[model samples]
Target: GAGVSQSPSNKVTEKGKDVELRCDPISGHTALYWYRQRLGQGLEFLIYFQGNSAPDKSGLPSDRFSAERTGESVSTLTIQRTQQEDSAVYLCASSFRGREQYFGPGTRLTVT
Candidate 1:
């Protein structure tokens, strides 16, 4: 079984640009979550998707951040008009029913 994976591992972008991060979750998992950890800060839930229901976007930082999951599988996070404050480690996790999620290596975004 393939575990969750995130691309780039690190990204450096200029402020006000747009960036896209990718995540590939394990097979058969029905729940996917996105979180952000800014340096030494704790993990902040950004969004979650379960099966076919509506995605939980309550934790998204602002209108610039958005995510989408395709049929309980792969997911992508897009940050539009990226700002300096958006620089952080974006993590992706997946599990069955949001229980015991497995994490990816994460994409470290650095805004300059």
Candidate 2:
């Protein structure tokens, strides 16, 4: 199976616009993660999904941020009423139980 893949490698949108980022994880991986990285900063964990359910979503910065994964397949991250501070690279990772994580190339989002 293929590694994780994210769509729209680059995205530029107005501050108030909404954006949807998609990620396709490797088949058979049971754990999926979403992270955000601001310019020059470390990756910030945003959410984690096991199978089709998310058990830890506390890392989501605000109500405007949300994510969901269907089983071990595709996942979507949505940002509503985007702000300048929301500009960053969104990364997705998937891992099998007790194995190392495989990260996606990431989606670079710029809010003007």
Best by TM-score: 1
The per-residue C-alpha lDDT of model 1 at residue 2 equals: 71
Candidate 2 all-Cα RMSD: 1.1
Each model's RMSD to truth, in Å?
Answer: 0.8, 1.1
Report lDDT (CA) for all predictions.
0.94, 0.92
- Each prediction's TM-score versus the true structure: 0.96, 0.95
What is the TM-score (0 to 1) of candidate 1?
0.96
What is the Å distance of residue 40 in model 1 from its true position?
1.8
TM-score of candidate 2 to 2 decimals? 0.95
